[model samples]
Structure formats: C-alpha cells, structure tokens
Target: MTLHPIESGNFKLDGGAMFGVVPKSLWTRTNPADANNMIDMAARCLLIEDGDRLILIDTGMGDKQSEKFFGYYYMWGDHSLDASLAKAGFHRDDITDVFLTHLHFDHCGGCIINNPNGNGYLPAFKNAKFWTNENHWNWAVNPNAREKASFLKENILPMQDSGQLNFIKKTTKDSFQTSSELDFGIFFADGHTEKQMIPRIDYKGKTLVFAADLLPTAGHIPLPYVMGYDTRPLLTLDEKAQFLNEAADHNHYIFLEHDAHNEIITVQHTDKGVRLKDTYTFNQLFK
Candidate 1:
C-alpha cells in the first residue's frame, strides 16, 4: 500500500476558537496566529492506494463557495485538491472511496462542486462511494444551532442525492475491515463532532491514525487545550485524554489534518500528561 499526502491548501481560523480556553500565550507558541488572531490551518487529506482501491480520507474546502462565504476563513495557499491529485498521478475518477470524517465544510466541501453550468451542486467524485456514519449524517443535515454553520448542505446533500452515500454502520469502536489484505480501521470520536470517524491504518509495521478534528494539531496534545468549536467541551477533554493515553501506550503516529507545519506527531506520557514527543511529516513515517 502507498500513501500520498494530498494538501488541498491552507486557511486561517481564529486561534482562540481553535484552542478554546487555552490562553493565547500557550497555543501561540505552537500555532502562532496572524494579526487577526487566525492561525494557519491545512486542509491536509490522505490518499491510500491499496490494491484496486484508492481511498481518499477527506476533501478539503472546495472552491465552489461564494467569495463572501470564503472570506471569513481567509484560505491562503497554492495547493488545491485537483492539483494534489494530479501530482499523485490520479484524478477524481480514480478515487473509489471518499471517507469523510464529518460533514464540516472544510472536511467535505471538496466532495461536491458546482455543476458544469452552475446549475446546482454535484458530486465531485462521481465514481467514489462516499462513506460517512449514519449518526453524523443526521446530526449534520439537521444540525443544531451550535454546529449549523460548519455543516454546509452544499458539501453533503449531493452525495446522497447522487446515490453514492454509504454508512459505515457499526459501533464507534468498530475497526476498519483490514483483515483480508486491507490494513485499516475506523475509530469513532464524538468530542469534535458526533461520530467523527478517524481512520487507523497499518503502514510499514507502524500504526498511523488520521487524527481528524479529534486532535487537530500537536498543540492540542496538552489535556486542557480543547477547541471552543466543539459542542461539548467536557466530552472533548475526556475523549482527548483517553485517546492520547492509548496513542502513547501503543506508540502510534498521529496524522494531523489541520497542522500546517507538523503533519505527523507521536505523544509520550509525561509527568504532567500526554505531550508531543516528536513531529514529522507523513512521508517521513512511511520512509
């Protein structure tokens, strides 16, 4: 199996929102914010080439949204989904699966695009079977006031409408069916979003987990540093603590989705709590 780092691009988000109650002085050390207090975030997705299946983890923020809508995020970078795929010697048609961690615009927006003549939204990956959990789908479609803004309909409805949506109907603890030559597992996390699915893959005798929003960046390794965007901050704290312990115990490498600088990181159990031990890019781990 081969893994490709598909960098869609970088965007800025309020540092305070990203770090929650954590003071600026603390998070700024790792993810320094701009004059606007927004930190650089990467819509870093992963592409797994396993035999006949080429699975894409998540689509970055697509370019279909209106300028006004995108102005808020302040996306800045040359990387694009199409360009990244082209670099990997593939196209949208080559993707057999679109495994969405959740329906947040940044995570799934690139899954849909404007129709040829700008008629309506359409599936970006016409041939790929979009994968999302049933619970998360419902939560996103009928979003509560807290998360309504993040779950954009343009990024989601098209999948089901295109007859390509499939639910990984199983417990959050259910592992990916990697037994028969496929080496991957699905871990469900609810702290960031309801039933956000994090993919765990066996690569080069090491376990690599797609950290999704569960652990957006290495800076979040500190226990109390939770994102203010999360619906239930306390749940996030509990989830992070439990997951960090497991990652540290097993020496797993976390594939960060939003960390612009650090793509992968490993945590160690320190006297205070689980803290980042080393940071590396995804390719470094595979090498």
Candidate 2:
C-alpha cells in the first residue's frame, strides 16, 4: 500500500476562531496571523492506494461557493483536489472510497461539485462510495444552531442525493479494524463534533492518526487549546487528554488538516503536560 498527501488548497481563517480561547500571543508564534487576525490553513487530505481501492480521506473545500460567501474566507494556493489527483497519476474517477472524518465544509466540500451545464450538485468522486458515520451524518444533516454554518448543505446533501453515500457501521468493539491495506481503525470522539471519526492508520508499522478538527495543528498540542467551534468544550479537554496519552504511548504521528505550516506532529508527555515533540510533512514519515 502507498499513501500520498493530497493538498486540496490553502485558505485563511480567523486565528481566534481556529485557536479558540487560546491567546493571540500564544498561538500567533506557531500560526502567525495577518492584519485581519486570520491565519493561513491548509486543506490537506490523504490518499491511500491499495490493491484495487484508492481511498481518499477528507475532500478539501471545493470551489463552488458564491463570491460573497467566499469573501468571508480568503483562499490562496495553487493546490487543488483535481490537480493533486492528477499529480498522483489518477483522477476523480479513479477513487473507490471517500472516507470522510466529518461533514464540515473544509473537510468534505470537495466531495461534491457543480455538475456540467449547471443542472445541480454531483458527486465529485463519481466512482467512490462516500463513507461517513451514521451519527455524524444525522448530526450534520440536522445540525444545531452552533454548527449550522459549518455544515453547508451544498457540501453534504449531494452525497445522499447521488445515492453514493454509505455509513460505516458502529461496532461495539473498542477499536474498529479494517482489512484493507490502509490498516486504519476508526475512533469516535464527540467533543469536536458528534461522533467525529479519527482514522488511526498503521502504515509501515507506525501508527498515523488523521487528527481532523480534534487536533487541527501543533499549536493545539496543549491540553487547554480547544476550538471555539467544538460542541462540548470540556468533553474536548477530556478527549484530548486521553487521546494524547494514547498517541504518545504508541508514538503515533498526528496528521493535521488545517495547519498550513506543519502537516504532521508527534507528541511527548512533557512536565507541563502533553506537548508537541516534532513537526514534519506527512511524507517525512514515509521517507
């Protein structure tokens, strides 16, 4: 099995929003903000090439929103979902499975796109089965007031409408095991969003975790650095503490979805608590 880092693109978001209650003086060092207090973020997704299946985890924000809508977040960068796939000698049609960590626009927007001739939304990966948990699917579709904005209908409804959506059955087991070469086990965390599935993949004997929004960047390594967008902030603290302990214990590498500067981070149990030990690009591990 071969794993490829597919960079969808880069966009800017309010540092305060990204870092939550964390102070500017603190998070700014790791993610320097612009005059608008917005920090650049990467919509980095992962692609796994196994024998017959090419699985893509999280599709970056697609270029379908209106100008006014896009004005809120400034997007910059040459990377694109299609372009990155082409670079990997593949196309959208080549994908067989799209495993979505969650339904947030930045994470799954690229899964659906405007159809040709402007009919309506269509599946971005025409040949892939979109995978999302039943709980997350229900939570996103029937979103609460706090999360309504992040769960954009344009980025979600099309999947179910296209008849390509499938739910990963919730198993009673502690860890979800996959027979595929990805060697990923889905771990559900409710703090960030309801039933947010973090893919823990064992690649080349090293456990690599797709941190999603649970741990967006290295700046979020501190136990208290929780996102403002999380539904249950206190639960996030508990979840992070537990997850970090496990990651550190197992020497797992965290794949950050939004950190424009650092793609992957390893944690260490420090005197102050859990802290980032090393930061590197995703490919660094494979190398």
Candidate 3:
C-alpha cells in the first residue's frame, strides 16, 4: 500500500478556539498566532492506494462556500484537492472511497459542490462511496445548537440524497474494528463529536493513525489542552489520555490532519504525562 499526502488547502482559525480554555501564553509556544490571534491550519487529507481502491480520508473545506462565509476563516494557500490529486497521478474519479472522519465542513465540504451546470448541490466524487458511521450521520444531519454551524447541509445531504452514502457499523462506542472493509482498522471516538472515526492503517511494520480531531496537533499532547469545540471536553480528556498513552507505548506514528506545520508526530511518556517526542514531514517519513 502507498500513502499520498493530499494538500487540500490552508486556512487560519482563532487560536483561542483551536486550543479551547488553554491560555494563549501556552498554545502560542507551539502554534504561534499572528497579530490577529489566528494560527495557520491545514486541511491535510490522506490518500491511501491499497490495491485498486484509492481511499481519501477527508476533503478539507471546499471552495463552494460564499466569500462572506469563507472570510470568517482566513484562508491562505494555493493547495486544492484536485491539484494535489494530479500531483499524485490521480483524480477525483480515481477515489473509490471518501472516508470522512466527521461531517464538519472542513473535513467534508469538498465532498459536495454546487452543480456546475445548474443550481443544486451534488456529490463531487460521483463514483466514490462516501464513508461515515451511522451515529455520526444522524448527529450531523440533526445537529445541536453547539455544532450546527460546523455541519453544513450542502456538504452533507447530497451524498445521502444521491444514494452514495455508506455507514460503517460500530461494534462499540469506542471499539476498534480491525477487520474493516476499508483495509484498515478504525477507532471510533466520541469526544470530539459523536462517532468521529479515526482510521488506523498498518504500514511497513508500524501503526499509523489518522489523528482527526481526537488529537488535532502535537501541542494538544498535554492532557489539559482540549478543544472548546468538543461537546464533551471531559470525555476528550479521558479519550486523549488513553490514546496518547497507547501511542507512546506502541511507538505509533500520528498523522495529523489539522496542523499545517507539524505533519506527523510521536509521543512518549514523560514526567508531565504524554508529550511530543518528535515531528516528521510526510516525505521525510513516508519517503
């Protein structure tokens, strides 16, 4: 199996929102903020070429949203999913699966787009079977006030409306499905959002986990540093503690999706609990 780092796009978000209650004095050390207190973030998705199935983990925030909507998040780069796919010798049509970690706009907005010829929205990847768990699907469609803004209808309903949406059955709330059909295991996490699926792939004798929002960046390795966006911040503390401990003990490589600067990171047990051991660029490690 081969892995390609898909550079979806880059944007900046309020550092306070990204780090939650964590003080700016602390988060800025790792993810330094600009004068506006906005920190750089990447919609860095992953493409897995396992046999004929080219699975894309997330699509990033697509370009379909209006300028006013996008202005809220300071977008800053030239990377686009289509352009990145071409760099990897592929296209949207080559993706057999659109594996969404969650239905947040940043993660799945590129899954749908305004119909080029007409008005309504449609699935961007007409051939790909969009993957999202049943619980997450329901949670997204009927979003609560806390998360309603993040789950946009245009980016979501088109898949189900078009009959391409597929659900991965969860054995347990946080169980790891080792025998998944996607040729990789998934650890379903509920802390960030209900049933946010984190994919675990076995590559070259090492376990690489797509650390969706469960572990957004290496700076989040510190136990108390959790995102305010989390509906259940307390649950995240426990989930992160357990996951980071395991990652440290097993020497797993964490593939970060949101961090633009730190592509991949590993954690180790320290007196202060799980702390980042090192960081690696996608090419530095994958090459």
Candidate 4:
C-alpha cells in the first residue's frame, strides 16, 4: 500500500477561533499569526492506494464559492486538488472511495464542482462512492445554528443528488473495520462535530491516523487547545485527553489536515501530559 499527502490549497483563519480559550500568548508561539491575526492553514488531504482502490480522505475547499464568500477565509496558495492528484499519478476518475472526516466546507468542498457547460453542480470524482456516516450526514444536512455556516450545501448536496453518496454504518465501538481491503479502521469523535470519522490505517508496520479537526495541528496536542467553533468545548477536552493518551502510548503517527507547516507528528507522554515528540514531512516518515 502507498500513501500520498495531497496539497489542495491554503487558507487563513483567525488564530483565536482555531485555538479556543487558549491564550494567544501560548498558541501564537507554535502557529504564529500575521498582522491581521490570521494564521496560515493547509487543506492537506490524504490519498491511499491499496491494490485496485484509490481512496481519498477529505477533499479540501473547492474553488466554487463566490469571491465574497471566500474573502472571509482568506484563501491563498497555488496548490489545487487536481494538480495534487496529477502529481500522485492519478486523476479524479481513479478515486474509488472518498472518505469524508466530516462535511465541513474546508474538508469536503472539493467533492463537487460547477459544470463547465454552465449546468448545475456535479460530483468532482464522478465514479467514486462518497463515504460519510449516517449520523454525520444527518447532522450536516440539518446543521445547527453554530455550525450552519461551515456546512455549505453546494459542497455537500450534489453527491447525494448524483446518486454517489454512501453511508458508513454507525458503529458503537471505538474502531470499526472498513469495507475496503486496505485494512482501514474508522475512529469516531463527537466533540468537533457529531460522529466525525477519523481513518486509521495500518501501513508498513506503523499506524497512521488522519487527525481531522479533532487534532487540527501539532499545536493542538495539548488537551486544552480546543477550537472555539466546536459545539461542546468541554466534550472536546475529554476527547482530546483520551485520544492523545492512547496515541502517545501506541506511537501512532498523526497526519495533520490544517497544519500548514507541519504535516505529520508523533506524541510522547511527558510530565505535562501528551506532547509532540517529533515532526516530519509525509515522505520523511517512509524514509
């Protein structure tokens, strides 16, 4: 099996919102903010090739929103989903499965695109089955007031409309094996968004986890660095504490999604609890 880190694009977000209640004095040290207080973030996704299946985890924000809509996020960078796929020797049609961590625009917007013929939106990955859990599918479609803005309809509804949407069965267990032969497992987290599925794959004698919004960056390794956007901040604290302890103990490499500078990181159980042990580029891990 081969894993590739796909660089979709970069955007800026308010540092305060990214690191909830955590004082700027602390988080700014790791993710320094610009003069406008917006920090650089990457819409980094992951692509996995195991035999006949080419599975993509998260799609990143697509270039479909109006300029006014995108201005709020401060989208930047030259990277794109199509170019990243080409670099990996693949195309949109090659993806057999799209495992969305959640339906947030930044994470799944690339799933759909405006038709070139001036028609309505269509699935970007025309032949792939879009995978999202039943709980999250419901949560996203009928988004609550707090999260409504993040779950854009154009980025989501088209998949179901195109008859390519498939729901992963809800599992009560912490981890459940996926239908794919890649031996992938889904770990569900509720603090960030209801039933956000974090993919855990056993690759090359090591466990690599797609650390979605649950752990957006290495700076979020601390238990208290929860996002202000989360509906339940207290629940996030508990979830982070439990997940970090296990990840540190098992030496799992976390694939960060929003961290612009750091792609992957491992944690160690320090006196201050779980702290980052080492950082690496995706290629560095294989070497």
Residue clash pairs of candidate 1: 176-185, 176-186, 178-182
Residues 3-117, model 1: lDDT tens digits: 8999998999999999998999999999998899999899999999989999999999999989999999998879999999999999999999999889999999999999999
Candidate 4 to native Cα RMSD, angstroms = 1.4
- For residues 164-223, could you state the per-residue lDDT of candidate 3 as single tens digits? 999887765446776366868888778899988889988877799999999887788898
Error of 4 at 196 (Å): 0.3
Candidate maximizing TM-score: 3
User: Whose lDDT is greatest here?
Assistant: 3
The window of 10 residues in a row where model 3 has the poorest summed lDDT is: 172-181
In model 1, where is the ten-residue run with the lowest total lDDT?
A: 174-183
Root mean square deviation (Cα) for candidate 2: 1.7
TM-score of candidate 1 relative to the true fold = 0.95
Task: Compose the digit string of candidate 2's lDDT tens values, residues 1-287.
Answer: 88898999998998898778889999898889999999888999999998898999999988888898878989897999999999989999999999999999999989988988898888988998999988899999999999999999989999999899998887665534452433468878889999888898878988888989889888888988888888999999988988899988888999998888898889999889988888887667787
Better of 3 and 4 by TM-score: 3
